[model samples]
Target: MAPRRCPCGTGLTYDGCCGRLHDGTATAGTAEQLMRSRYSAFAVGDPAYLLATWHSSTRPGRLELDPDVRWTGLEVLGTTGGSLLAAEGTVAFRASRLDDGVPGVQAEDSRFVREGGRWVYLDGVPLR
Candidate 1:
């Protein structure tokens, strides 16, 4: 089968985008990239990857994605700072999901920080 399209909305195959990050062959180089990969993780139902990429500072003891919720798409609204050369950044995005056939959208402005040369999600504030 052809490689699946990335759920991150990058218009690239999974392997060429978030799959490499999910499978340990690559790391996101910027806050936006990291944000995209996180959305992919949720879309793919990999809560482990989500926790693994969370900043220790704000990471919770555990995370669980509702089994009924199926992520469908991601749309990055904007970003600032978090680059290979920057220590922190914020990404504003909206993600669509369907739970029990009920469609919904979640929007947030998420914070990210570079630690040990990798970007980790710190936290997020909901957006309207």
Candidate 2:
């Protein structure tokens, strides 16, 4: 069987992309990479990966994904900093999903920062 494509839309195999991060074999090299991996986590239904990559200050004690919401696609609109050398950064994206069979799109500009030299999601501002 062929390897599944990554949900991050990186055109790479899941194992070569976010899967490595999800499985703890790799760490995000940038904030944007972390954001993409987080989205992949949601698509693949791995809340543990989500919580592990989340910043401690804003991380919830537990995360429960709504079963009715099915992630469909991801579009990265823009990014700032979030480079291998940057300490902080932001990623703007629109994530498409189906909620109870209803189509929806969530747009947000997310913030990220390096903690212990690893990129972690901090927070996000919903875009209208």
lDDT of each: 0.93, 0.96
For residue 113, model 1's alpha carbon misses the true position, in angstroms, by: 0.4
lDDT of 1 by residue, 76-106 (tens): 9999898789999999999999988899999
Best by lDDT: 2
Question: lDDT per residue, candidate 2, 24-98, as tens digits?
Answer: 999999999999999999999999999998899999999999999999999999999999999999999999999
Model 1, TM vs. native: 0.96
Tell me how candidate 1 scores on lDDT: 0.93
Error of 1 at 35 (Å): 0.4
Off by over 4 Å in 2: none
Task: Report the number of backbone clashes for model 1.
Answer: 0
